[model samples]
Target: MHSHTNLIAVLLLTVLIHEGSAIWCYRCTSATPGCGETFNWRGIGYLGEHCPEPDDICVKLTERRGGSETITRDCLSALNFRKDIPADKYEGCRPAAKDERLAHYVNHTIKEHDVRRDYFTDTTFCFCFLDHRCNGASGMQVSAVMALLTVAAALLLR
Candidate 1:
């Protein structure tokens, strides 16, 4: 009947709304050799994952120890993203305030030669837009909600 048709239309609209609003970002971790062309790859070492929350931002962390280096990439909270870049940094992610020594994220060590001369060094943290794409909601959610309201009105009219 007409009610069944309206239900189908609403469901289809809901699916379209969800699909258009979905946001995804790259996720990965690498050490020594580093993750090659992280933005380009899609499998194994690099993965495309959903950015679930509103404040999620893509993060890249690099650590250097004598000759070796380590890198990690993932979606992280923007509240912890710092502005000040330090010289001779020893932790992956740190607070913007210089007095704070707590690292917001990952921290690890490296050995200069075999396991004899192990040393931990400072890390550099960088935040970038997810795939240089998503800039948050972009009013898509609002539009979807409006669409649902329209569908409800149409049903009521019938």
Candidate 2:
């Protein structure tokens, strides 16, 4: 009798945990911090406003060293950035900074006409990362484990 109540309580707690997780997932996916860039469910990557068509624009900005330069790059060129995207929205493929050193190296190598050496020496790579607040997969696994443990305990009592 009391054990039945305990089973019901565990089941209710499991449902609550699942619901909370679902809500958290929704918030994280649609939230500005997450940018909806990764870890999507049901094949939906991002929600809300569609990112404006990208354009190749002359990006004029000052580097960390305070050197100003202009470079032509294709970016999601919306004059008014989307509200849902993070303030410093960085897609992995996009170049966040104008690496002047790299540009100089490329030009120098090109002038020398050393194709193989130039290609290898002048090539520079930078990494961009997406933010993840909650481990969606891990969270689901933990939730499953909790539910399974609850079930196992309930069955053992019977």
Candidate 3:
């Protein structure tokens, strides 16, 4: 009985550790610019999703066109970022500033045949924690881990 209990405790600890290491982030795609309602839309809403392998960062891309901004959020594999996406578009997936949500902004101005066009983009990336809180799937993960720990403790006490 003692050895069996020890084995169970070890298995539970291993599972909890494994689950805790999994990373997740918020994902959303929008046709509208500014993304003011990105987190609050009723249809096709933002989802708390697990990051793919080697995708340790959460990325948000905001494009400004005709004085409006469109945003896309997803998980990105850090090593493949440069190889997969154009450097001119992504710039760099940096972290947001203190008290500020924007990570980086890039602007491009083109002049052609006496016509002037401007393009602007903003990129924001971060770990699961921001402003002292987890913004996405991290919350659910925490809750699950806690419940598992509670159950494990209860079983051990019995």
Candidate 4:
């Protein structure tokens, strides 16, 4: 019985570790060498940071001005430490409402947009909690590692 309990503990730890692994996100902007609209992961290398909260979602903000676009990737926790964004509310990609683009975050709420309302015409926001470094130009629908960990934990619990 004691050995069984130990085994369960190990399994639980493994599952937790796996889940935590995905809490990291690519953190950068178009200004970075390879962090533009088309991310050049190979040349610039991975520039990422871990999320402050486990439940935080990776967010990719794409702003288009006339013909040019800029991309910013980061964790919502990094974006807003004052609050937690309910994952269900922002799990996919959508056009950001005009007023929300420069909303309050604990950090980097807005740059030039804070003063100028005519910064960008089109703003795209994509959110994901799929896996490590999941934030990109688009939000991915599947979180396979999470599913696999859930199944493993369930089987172990059983």
lDDT of each: 0.49, 0.34, 0.47, 0.68
Collision count for each candidate, in order: 2, 0, 2, 0
Q: In model 2, which range of ten residues has the least summed lDDT?
A: 124-133
For candidate 4, report its TM-score: 0.61
> Model 1: clashing residue pairs?
89-122, 90-122
Q: Between candidates 1 and 2, which one is better according to lDDT?
A: 1
Off by over 4 Å in 2: 13-22, 25-135
Residue by residue across 47-92, what tens digits does model 1's lDDT show?
3576667545555666567877665655654324433444323323
Ranking by TM-score: 4, 1, 3, 2
Number of the predicted model whose lDDT against the real structure is largest:
4
* TM-score to true structure, per model: 0.40, 0.26, 0.40, 0.61
27-142: candidate 2 lDDT, tens digit per residue: 22223343233434444444323223322111111112234222211123432332222244333223232333433445443455733222222221111212111223233465
Candidate 4: give the clashing pairs: none
Query: Candidate 1 has what TM-score?
Result: 0.40
- Ten-residue stretch with the least lDDT total in model 4: 81-90
- By lDDT, is 1 or 4 better? 4
Off by over 4 Å in 3: 1-21, 32-37, 45-47, 78-118, 121-123, 126-158
Measured on C-alpha atoms, candidate 1 has an lDDT of 0.49
Cα lDDT for residue 71, candidate 4: 87
